[model samples]
Target chain A: MCTGSEANDLALRVAKQATGHRGVIVTENAYHGVTTEIAAISPSLGGVGSLAEWVRTVRPPSGDGTAMVADARTAIAELQAAGHGVAALIVDTAFASDGFIAPSAETRAALAAVQALVRAAGGLVIADEVQPGFGRLGARGAGSGAAEASLWGFPRHALEPDLVTIGKPMANGLPVAGLVARRDLMQAFGERVRYFNTFAGTPVSVAAARATWDVLHDERLPEHAADVGDELRGMLAELAGRHDRLRGVRGSGLYLGVDVVDPESGDPDTPAAVALVSGLRERRILISASGRDNAALKLRPPLPFSRADAERFITELDGALGDLG
Target chain B: MCTGSEANDLALRVAKQATGHRGVIVTENAYHGVTTEIAAISPSLGGVGSLAEWVRTVRPPSGDGTAMVADARTAIAELQAAGHGVAALIVDTAFASDGFIAPSAETRAALAAVQALVRAAGGLVIADEVQPGFGRLGARGAGSGAAEASLWGFPRHALEPDLVTIGKPMANGLPVAGLVARRDLMQAFGERVRYFNTFAGTPVSVAAARATWDVLHDERLPEHAADVGDELRGMLAELAGRHDRLRGVRGSGLYLGVDVVDPESGDPDTPAAVALVSGLRERRILISASGRDNAALKLRPPLPFSRADAERFITELDGALGDLG
Candidate 1:
């Protein structure tokens, strides 16, 4: 695949073809890719109103397995009523646009419940690991179990997803992405459909991906990210104690999100988040805001971002917050 | 765009958005891209039966403008009756999959006639130059006018296409493609929708495209291709006189095709073409078969293929044909 969008677009097609259904279920504020079909399922792009008729949006998992399961049931019913039975339920592991939901037992259980419900309805589960996979969510030991397999290197996750899409950091910069799925599902689709892209799987692109993989293992970049991410979170938590505007900090590994809230009503302060993002840019500490309301400061840095770099970010963020006040 | 598929996919979206129509018209056996929506309009993929309800296909111009125009009228009527209306008519400038249709005054006139009819129905014209654009076709003098603009470099084609997609050889090897459209159409789509690809327009990708452009002009590659292509076609014609299997040669610049036919019936000999391709491979000369029946020998070499290379190709082809007999 040339981009993550292509991977996701292909994933949807594979799901529909393998399951013989056309309906799709995605999380609210979910962003899978930019292609026409992928974009139609990406509610984060233009909101739920922009979704195609065959698509249904469920709210992102919020620890309450009951609500998430109930929403999935409703969405599945809606799709079935429309004559487009559920084909797949796709979700970004990080839930980046849904305020970067943190990984936890409850979160995992909520996801599993939704996946189970979709599978029971004869729909596949697609974990979009484009953002949270590839060691961005920290490294887990071998056999850490299927729950831990959402991140790269922990392939033994207990949850058996029908398809998993990976991209963005695969080749570091070169265009490369792929879809990992059950052998039977792949064979079913591959036997009938002839999928070919001009530059996909080219020698140079594959070489880049191989080199990046080798570097990641040789340097133990995931471990490095884990350590630095811990320090960064600690610093942000300390800063939050000092500044009331800093509402909360959450996320895993290097992909952390800091919430900025209105001091008066404790509501999401989108303008304040925007101001802080601009301030960080002015101070030469690059960062951006994400989530549905753009209230969470998205801090996804390079795997090699060091403790010293974290210190600089913390220092600049502190100064920027003070200046804002 | 990262690849031609993405470019075409985006082009369709832009066309639909700008024109406020859902119908699409493409040539018979045309392949534009691989995305789901694109694959629907691409008749060469799964045949006309697999075409989406909104899509209609017309025969390629074969020197008969009247028949082509009538086909377009029927397709338009079908689309209109289906309530899809007409959004755009996309064509590969070289007609590569349609066995590399040679450019001619009749071909251009037929294309212009189809464009006029589609325009009258408020549909835009999209030129997919992924194969023949970017100087792959012979070069023309600066300001050579509309007749010369069918090839790359000259943009003054009498037909002002609403969008033109270019890719494949743009960066020589790197995956880089772009959609060049009229400003108003682009603006209309851009204002309502946001489009971004991860690796597209990166510094490295852009540099590669820029360097390729500089070399195309500085090395006069288009002119070189023209000279070599003419020599190669002449040699193939000379060889055809000796071998009854060799039928006809056609194309422009580096993009040329040779027809292989049965000696007695003068009908396409697909096996003979396949054997010839294999024979050339045995001789360490690389080429491929094209056309709906896979009977035409596709001889699209690098722009820098020289007269010496042409001689070598002719020698190898002559041997292959002899061995086949």
Candidate 2:
């Protein structure tokens, strides 16, 4: 696999083969990848048609996660009724497009319950960690060392998926991606399908990935992300009190989302979010907005981002937010 | 696109959108790519099931290509009858898997006719040049410089395709691939679908591709491939006259296929092909077998392969063939 899409595509294929079914479940607005099969599951890549008949989507995790569980139950029932039995439930553990939602206690329970429900429906669980993989979603608070942090999002959420898809930060800009699957499931796929990709697992790619892995652990960048992210979030929260449009801040590690809203109405302010993004761009700070209404600022800086860099960004963001008014 | 599979996958989607049809035509044993959609059209990646109902395969181009056209006609009729109207006809111009078939006069006519027929049926023609692209199929004979060479395979046969897919050599070993489509078709696709992929056309990847392109032209590697390939093919032909097991040689420029046959019965000798491949590997001259029966030695050396390297390979191949005897 040379891209996250290819890895997710293969993961779906493996899940389908192992489960002997065709139905797929995804979080609403979840973005898995760009491949045909994976794209169909990614509701965020909207096109002329709805999702394929074999695919269903549940509401993204929020609050107590009860609504999401209800949506999942309905999706499962609909899929079963349609005769396309459940094959897999693929999720981006960070729920990035769902506004980089931080985990709540009930959300954790819902994730575990959803995993069990999918398994009971004869489907595998695929954790797509392309956005929150390779120590990006470090666990413990600011002062904790890298050794104590969870390197991937699924583990942080206590998820034991049958397959895991990783990419993006893999080779630190080089094209390298991979699918990690349970041995029995992979063997089942290998017995029937001859999976192949030209640029996958090449010597140079593997060497680059290994080099990146070495730097990720040796320099303790994950812990650095956590420490700086905690400080950055605290500053953003302080900024939120000053700027009424900055509704809230959420997420963990270096990945954070700031809800942009109308000051009076308190509704999602997509125009304000767009203006804020452009304002930040003018200030030489790169950021984008995502979510159902595209009104949440997505701030996922490089792993080695530091407190000084964070302060510089916050200053610029403060200026940009003032400019937005 | 970061891989050939991605490019082909995008091409298929674009073609389907432009034509508003679902049926796809491909050569038997043709290899498009590994993506879920493209793989369904590639017969060579054998698995448990047949091609999807919307896909139809024609015989690979050979000797006049009449049989191939006949097969195409039947496939078109079948698809139309099945309510899957023609969307596109995708071909690897070199026909590498069908024993590296070189175009005959009739074959060239057949190609032109097929293109016209596909367009008449409201389908686009996609030339998959991952294997035969980047100046590997020079038009003029040996001793000619780079100017006269057709740097791509489709132009060698004077076949105008609506889309062209390229990979492998674009960025040397870096993961870079692309699909070149007519502006009209691209615009049509743009109006309907929202296609996106991460790691496509990044600055570093573009820089690598540009550097490779500069060297390819500055050093006239395609011209070198042509001149060296001409001599290599001539030498192989002479060697074929002496070796009883050597049945015939096909292909042009640097990409060639040598058929291995049982000396007495003149039938394809798959075992001998496998043994020759192993023998070459043992001698540190890596090569592989292709074609439906896996009895054709596929010789696709690096573009800069010189006369001296060809001579060394031939000497080793000669010894390997003798050892087989």
Candidate 3:
């Protein structure tokens, strides 16, 4: 496949075949991709009401994360009652669209529980790692030169996914994406259908991915992101101490977010977020708002962002917040 | 869009919105693309039985082409009775998947009538020009220098399509494809939904398409295809006279197809096509089989194919056919 949507679509198809079911479960405000079937499951694109009947949405794990277990249980029961038994519970482990929640111990446990629950109900687990793969979250390797423990987000939650989808950053702007599935599931689907795409796995695309991977590993970009992200998050936290409008500074590695709210009411202030983003734009910085109400600033800078770049962004953000006032 | 499937999918979305209907009509063996929605309308991928309830299939025009009008009328009535009404009739004007029929005068007139009928019923006509666009059918410009009469297939039939989908060869081999639509339909869909894709219209993709277009025009590749295709067809016809298994040497420009048949029974010979194709591969030539029975040799050479190249191919084909005996 050449796009993330196609990979996710194929993932669901294989999962459905493996599970012998038709229903799917995803986070309420999740974004998978832009293909027809994948788009129907991406509530962030058109809201949950626009989702297909076979798709059920659950709240993303927040706080202690146990609440999402209950949500999944309810969703599973409802799908069972509708006679569309669960085929898969697909998740963007970064939770980027649900306001970029970092996985706490409780959230990880909850995710593990949900994975077990879905499997027990004959559903597979699909980890949409498009956002959190390729060392975007943090260092998967333990030492500077040792073998990496894990570069994928799902491994952190200790969940063994049946299917893992990766895209976008794999080839550093080239169109390349794929679905990595269990051997048994892949064999089963391969026996039934032959898949071929004219633009898939082209020589240039593969070469680009290989070059990017070599550079990423040689430069230790993931470790750099982790170090710089930690430093940047601390700077933002300090800035939040001075700016009452900025709240809830949280994220992992370079993918971070902070809520823009009304100082007096503490409610999401979309206008404030918009104004801050515009103000930053004037200062030659670029960022975007994400989540349901579009009040959380999604600060996913490039993987190679350095500490100096982080300082410049923090400095500009400080001025932008002050200008917004 | 980065693939033809995405472009066709978007075309359908716009058409369905424009007509406020859901039914789609396509040729019985037509192939649009591989996306979920588009694949359902592509009977060449699966059988017509795999079509969605909102879809109807009509036979491709063969002899005089008037028979397709009756098929369209019946399909339109069935869709209306099923309450799907008619959203669009998408046709690959080249009819590549229906065994690559050249546009005859009667078939052209029948297409015009079907277009009128579809419009009168409040449906749009979509020209899927992926196979026949960009001068594949011959020199759109008369006399090699005058402004091109028409570079697209639909204009050759004097049909004004509501939407046209193009892909694959647009940027040579790079991933670039798009949908051209009537202004009002695009406006209606745009007002309701904002479309965005991560890799669409990237600078590199745009540059690639522009470079390819420049080379195509500078070298007069379309005119070359026209000249070479004519000579090639004549050579194949001459060969067909000697080899009973070679029949129906028909097509336009460089996109040609010939039926591989049993000499004694005059029926499609899949094994013979397989053997001929495999034998050609052994001779370092490449070709493929098309049509439902996989018995028609699809001869879609590059636009730059010259008279010399055509002669070489004919020589090999003559030997291959003789070897078949």
Candidate 4:
């Protein structure tokens, strides 16, 4: 794998090969990757009606475990009826594109139900950790205080995914990614097919990944991020109390999302989100908006971002909001 | 693009977007890249019947312009009958996997005719130069001494491909590739889609590409390769005169392929080729075999392969052949 896209693409290939099916299920706003096959299943890239015929989309978990399960069941049935038996259900574990869904018991249960339904349909579960992996969601079983655990750190009892795609922060900047799956599944695919990509597993790229991993562990970056993120969340919550436009702050660790809304109607304010992002850029503190409506301020800084850096970011954000008002 | 696979993948996407068609054409044993969609069009990957429904394969040029043109026409007609309008025809200009076909006026005319037929059906022409680009085929219009020019150095009158994918040697080994297409075709695709790869065009990768280009020009590697390749070709032809198993040597520059055949039948001899490759490896001289039958000794040494190095390779190959006998 050379990128998150390649990892996801390989994962899909493996799932289809292992299950002998073509149907795929993904969240309505999910973004798995940019490859041709992955892009077909990534609805966030091209909105509704852009998906491949073998693909079906379900709403992201919204606390109703039964409804989410029903949605997965329906998607599986639809695919089956269309002659494409269910192959896999892939999702970004952090729900980054679906406005960064908060980690709660209900949300977790919904996800669990969906996973069960997909498995019952003989489909594999793929956790795409391109966004939330590499300690961005904190250490394993650190609990809700650290929010959702990305694939690499997810507790065993929480979810048992068949395949996990990891990328983005793996090699820091060099292109490198990988798909982790059960030995049997990999062996099955390997026996039937040969997979090769130029520049994949290059010595230089692997060296970079090893060094990055060493640095992360040596510096205890995950714990550091957890502590600084908690502080940042509290600061943002405090600011929300002062500003009516600041709806709420959600997400875990350093990957927080701040909702910007219209005070009058409580609707997402895309213009204000745009203004604040531009203002932050003007102040030389870069940030961007995410979510389907692009109204949630996405704050994902370097792993080395410290408490002082958090304070500076909060102060600048506060000033920008005030100026906008 | 971060790799040749990604470049070819992007080229397919752009072609489909620009043409609004689904059908693809490729050589019978062609290997475009490793991406799923590209692999489907690459018949050599999984053999016959593994091609996507929208993909069709044609015989590569075999020095008969009329026959090659007929093959292309038949493939296009079949795809059209299957309701998949022609989208594009992608080929490795070097015919690398097809055993490095010697460039001749008949072969060039055959390729041109195929291009004309594909374009007439509203399909784009994609030149995959991952294996032959970056001065590997020498400067444009250097004739048979230079062989078929790759996209990066193709003479203007040779062929006007609609899109070209370049990689492998672009940045030395830093995983940099690119898709160059007509402005309007690119503009149309960009309007309907957005393409982004995480590590594409990174500063370090671009710096490497720039430095590689500077060195190629400063040392005139293309010209150097052409000169040395001629000397190597003469030596290999002399070897063929001595050994009945050596059928012939073909290709231009350092990308030469020596045909290994059974002395009695004149048919491809894969075992002899394999034995020679292993013998070279044992001597710490690395090389591999190519062609559909894996009977052509692929000698794509570095562009810096000197005359003395060629003599050494030829001497070792002579000894290896003698040992095999």
Candidate 5:
């Protein structure tokens, strides 16, 4: 069993301990976890605990996927030349909490590119899928959109990582997760010591996951998430364009980010983000900041959140934006 | 809530972050957890992991307790004077995973004294109650002793700490824990950033704790454990002087450890310890090596063990020890 935080920690540890890799790689504005290891790999995102010695941050990819992929290659060499061996490449599947932003086609390919590089460098790749799994990305109320596209557009299918870490809604808060690796790594872990959590494989949490998956599949929440996500993005776009403080919209499926901005320069708007998030809470819609300093509003409603809820959220956001004005 | 490993990790994090201490002070033979923090803090404990930076070890007390405590004091001063902050004074209580070997009273007193000095120097102290809490020490039957003792120990003694993390059997195998801090610290954490875990506070786990606690208090297991522990120790003592390999006993309440050695050279008889544990397991009593390379045989039965069971265990142990001949 792994907390999203622990999953990341063990991921780094596995890389460092197993392959003799000293250089750990992460991405800008990426969140690993609240613990020391996870935060260490993340740069200024939450790396305040003086763990930079163990991390190398690659700039997050923007429009061009190839450049993003190239960025990973550069990071590996730089780290290796600096005498720190690259052990593994760590990537979060979607920038869900950071900005609800999914990687571009080029960025996804870059992820694949680096996977091969890291493996040749005697490193592994760990994909963090905590938020996207369990059908949160395909809610129907969001309007059928790109999220429901074929395997090519499917976010998780974008990369075939060596290891995958998942948690959160896996058991609907029942507290269970698995650090599933390829047969080799799993055997290595199993051979050294059998891993078991007292509460990890609990019958109760297992039951919860089974029940939750049934509900998700039976109701086709993933498909629904796509519908709601497309519609929500359309509505959010109008809000972002109309308001001077609201920046561009990022994210796909139901995982969305309402980028707050500095009214004057349109730079990262930390204060605006806080105001809007707090404002949403006052209006009785739970939402909070995503990355460092509460710079982006994270909107991760349950998979079952309906269109009415989305409309109501946008309506309140419109009013909240006006109140700030 | 937290696991034994997490509890230990958080303890050190508080110590270092709170005290500005970089180096950790540990006993020569100690097992903290399976995480990086614990591994850094406890290097001598035998596990798959290796040593980490900023860790300093000292030999355990030699019955007088003076040697070890003095070692700690001297080590802390040296580390601090050399620009290392002695953030917190951390130690497993008298009996640690080192086969429940209880330090002498003097050693215990010295530890508390050094911790007080460290606290005076602006550090914290964390008591890892994961192994012994909730009636494990005094428990005789299926969680009755340990569980009851833990509940009453905290609420009754007013052993208020700056922080306390409890997990592992909190839900009888449910992944849940409580990171209890003084209101101020928790408030500070909340103020800086909101913290939430999907599975850390599972309702089913909560229910299990409630059920476990209910059975504990209702069954009067603590008294039974105390009653049984006394009997078990006496039997072990009678056998101790009789056997050339048996040296001494460690721990309190129901948690007991039999010293296995030539009773003369004072060197650890690791192979013998392993044999006895394996033999016990083969005989259908599940146990493991407690600390430091199978040096001490461990026996932690469910809380609801009975006097008849203890008698049976004694018979089996005598047979196993005789087989060592």
Candidate 6:
């Protein structure tokens, strides 16, 4: 539970070795982890660790999603030309560091587009499924979101990832994570390399993981997450409409981001975010201000959060923001 | 439980980086671990890794005390001439692979002699405390034998091991291990190179370690280990006197190795060792063969074992060996 950083770095290493590439292309506001290799690639957590060479950080697509994709494509081409065998195009879904922003399909497609370019350049594709995995952010019940959103999603795997690294909230601080790759890729990886972690893949952790998944599925927590998320987002958006300092609110499912801004300029207003978090903590809630000059307050609670709980949280947040007026 | 081979290889990477040396000095027949690095140094463990050009194996002295130390000193000189810088001296304590044989004080001092040579050469001293740590094997009543022995007997913080790794029996097969280091050296290692482990310092593991240590101390397992060890050794010795194939036995307190030899030639017998282990296992009493030719049968029981338990085991082993005869 210390961080999701190590697993991300190992993922990069395995991809680099497997694909025989030195360059890693990551999202602009990406916060994959806080390790040297990851931080270098991660624009947000870069200061968290020493950034190394061969990590090409690219802008995660913005409001102008088309331009964002173009920026990433250009960045990938430059790094490839600079002799960095583009290893893997990695993207962190439910980008917590980037205002808890869920990328639009165009943004995701553009990201996927760059990945396609890397694959064309003989690179692998790695997905950071740390968050938004295990059915947290998308469809509520049994139906898959991409499948319901489009025929492509419902029919089969949407983004056929070469490797997937996951951690955080898997077992609610139980500290169990893993990397899932295509069987053939794993076999190739195992040709001469053997990987065994003393702690990871232990029976106890496996039990915890299985049990956590069972608990989540049995309770249908994702549905509850969606309902609560919608409630919380509406409440926060309404509060922002009432308060000029509150600029925006957005997210998918339970993980939401409330962007507080300067009353006069609408520029990222961080002090008010700090004030809100501190006030909320005083009321016995636990959270932190991160993303967007700490102006964006990220709210990610444990699964199985009740709708009433969301209502209560929104009530408290509304009251807190009202005091700012 | 992974193979014993990989464990040693991981240790080697840290050893080299910590010592900043290209050459590793491991005693002959010392089972460092079961990875490529360890297998190459192990003299036996079977398949070897791409043996990096940095390791220099040394012979632990025979018969004469301290000659092992002399051998290590000479080994250091040889390594330097061959362009391998002395990184650290790794000892498996009781070369259990060689019948739980311990280097004499002269040998220890001679090995300790390299302390200066390697230190001047900016090296480290690592003791593989996997077997002897955790008050098992008749160590101190409170802490590991090495910790107790080194803290009091060896010069205070002498050798100042850059890394002292201990595992097995620490959590009673709960899968927990650690490297206790001098705080400053640990800091230096961390500063120079970061080594982060996901499961190494988990909360449950921390609790397990604390509880395990408590059980060892509160139950006086170490004291019992010494008592039962003395009884077991004495009984085995007595049995050896009657059995012609039994040459001798060696060990500290609990962790004993019963040496076997050919009756006619009075030479170490390898076949008897394997047969003896197989015999014991058939009786549902688990014990493994160790030392040269697998000539010594390893007797490592839980610390809480009793004289009655030892007697029962001895009876079973005796009956098994008798059947073999």
Model 3, span B59-103: residue lDDT tens: 876778778899999999999999999999999988889887666
Each candidate structure's TM-score, on Cα atoms with residue i matched to residue i, is: 0.95, 0.95, 0.95, 0.94, 0.83, 0.69
Question: Which stretches of candidate 2 lie above 4 Å from their native place?
Answer: A47-49, A141-149, B139-149
DockQ score, prediction 1: 0.74
User: Residue B287 deviation, candidate 3, in Å?
Assistant: 1.6
Scoring model 3 with DockQ, what do you get? 0.57
Give the Cα-based TM-score of candidate 3 against the true structure: 0.95
Higher-ranked by DockQ: 2 or 4: 4
> What stretches of model 3 exceed 4 Å from their correct place?
A143-149, B143-149
* lDDT (tens digit, per residue) of candidate 2 on B134-197: 8877545355543544778886666899999999888887788999989988988888776777
RMSD of 1: 2.3
Question: Candidate 1 chain B — worst ten consecutive residues by lDDT sum?
Answer: B147-156
- Worst lDDT 10-window in candidate 5 chain A: A147-156
Candidate achieving higher DockQ, 5 or 6: 5
Q: After superposition, how far is residue A13 of candidate 3 from its true place, in Å?
A: 2.7
Query: What value does DockQ give for candidate 6?
Result: 0.13
DockQ of each: 0.74, 0.67, 0.57, 0.73, 0.33, 0.13
Please, what are the lDDT tens digits per residue for candidate 3 over residues A83-136?
Answer: 999999999988899987776798888888898899989999999998888888
Please give, for residues A36-143, the per-residue lDDT of candidate 4 as tens digits.
998999888898677899999988877655666778889999999999999999888778888776666777888888888888888999988887888886553356
Q: Model 2 — interface RMS deviation?
A: 1.4
Evaluated on the second chain alone, the candidates' TM-scores are: 0.94, 0.94, 0.96, 0.93, 0.83, 0.86
lDDT tens digits, residue span A1-325, model 2: 8899999988987887788888999888888887777778888878315577899888777788887789889989999999999999999989998677677678788888888888999999999989899878755544544354477888666778999999999988788899998999888888888777778886667888999999987888877888888999999999999999997798998999999999999999999999999998998888998888889999999998889999999999999888876
Q: Among these predicted structures, which one has the highest lDDT?
A: 3
